[model samples]
Target: MSVETDKIEIAFEQLVDIQNTIDTVLKVPKNPGHIGVRDMLRIIIGPQTDSDQEKLSEISSNFLARRQFKALLKSQTLASQTKQAAASSKTTSGQVRRSGDDFDLNLIPSTGDDKLFYMQLKVKNHERFAQISKAEMLFVESKGVFSSVPLPEILDGVSQIMIRQGHPVLDAFHDPEAEFFIK
Candidate 1:
């Protein structure tokens, strides 16, 4: 394999290792099914250098602060397109043509099967509101560790999937619940 490919494989392996470790931890019976965001972040980021830790905290905080409304807009655009297609066929049931209200955010973690962390954000008339687009929870696993990825990456991934699959995942990370930024 090429050098670049090898590097990618290594990175993927590391992620997998992390995921597996978390999975094992979650497997313990009677263990709390849910972990706090702080604990989860610590496990993923590790103990950074003072500055690095500070930066991670800042980044996390900033991510949590972003308004899901922006994400909603991107989602709505596609919803509109689907509406157009449905309009042509006189089938309004398959697509949503009207925009919806701002996002209704919900943070949920797994219980028995702790391999997926779900964040469900819903916008009530998704097409007409145009200003808001609902972002559903997306289950992503790296080596079996179940947790949400970063917000920017999640948004980008959702946007791409919406273009490809007609909608995004059912759960994903959006603006988190915190006040910090990565420096």
Candidate 2:
């Protein structure tokens, strides 16, 4: 076989070994709830001396750094796509108009005459609102004026406003408690 083919085979074998090591480490009863890369590496390498543990730690750090770099690249791609889509949809009139089918407006609160004033504010200024961050919105919603409204109702109103204003309505931040796991 060519040198390139041999290198590929070696890489595949290493990947299989790593996977088996991960499986074995996960099966250990003494392992912590959240396992760091070093912990996993130490478990796999079975370090007998201080020097061995230090070497394993260095290797784990490099592995984690590479993984983080890859994750950043993926996140950048997604962010770029989202930005491009948002920019392309913009009109000269300064208003973003999305087709009803593009997003589910019904996912958020319904704004009627009887709705709370704060809910109306959320519905009106979904984009460029004072409480832009999710944590800030949650804190604000916990107060007396906004407290009466359910969190979902507030989020729905906010989401509707955001969708109308041509901003990305990240459901993860809006309703974190919702089960999104695939069955």
Candidate 3:
């Protein structure tokens, strides 16, 4: 692996070590399931560093402030990712890092396969997305635990399977008598 690849992996490890907040923050790979308020609370209150927790809070506040974040936060589950299919991520266009929104300089080191299983999984996901008429989620396999390129906070950068029905999990987070569905 290149020096750059090593650096990206280290950064990814830093994120994984902190907490599995990426899924919750990004609200992707929804991983079909149901968790009651009790379980949800446990995850949000689980073992995470103070700084990590703060980073999660800041992330929600910064990009997703417009949404009902408290409700969303309450809806968080301790779920791991399940396979989903979606479109591909954009690649580097040039040496430039930012060409408006998309990263033109997606300088992650190349590798033939991270592991055979993961590579097959990635290939299957890509193929599955191609078949789905309206694919909402994508199982993005980075170069490895550390991707070859630096991944940024993908808020509006990536399109998702937009669930406009007002998050199903978040419904449990709300007070039954207080909040109504949708604004």
Instruction: Output the better candidate (1/3) by lDDT.
Output: 1
Q: Where does the lowest 10-residue lDDT sum fall in candidate 3?
A: 141-150
What CA root-mean-square deviation does each model show from the true structure?
21.5, 21.0, 26.1
Winner by lDDT: 1
Overall lDDT per candidate, in order of appearance: 0.33, 0.31, 0.28
lDDT of 2 by residue, 1-183 (tens): 699999999999999999999999888586233445554333232333345334333433464533442333233221111111222233454323322211211233326444312212232333523332221211111001111111233354343222231221322223322111100
Q: In model 2, which runs have C-alpha deviations exceeding 4 angstroms?
A: 1-86, 91-93, 97-154, 157-183
When 1 and 2 are scored with lDDT, the better candidate is 1
Higher-TM-score candidate among 1 and 3? 1
> Per-residue lDDT for 147-173 in model 1, tens only?
222332324122222211211222212
- TM for every model, in the order presented, reads 0.21, 0.16, 0.18
Candidate 1, position 98, lDDT: 17
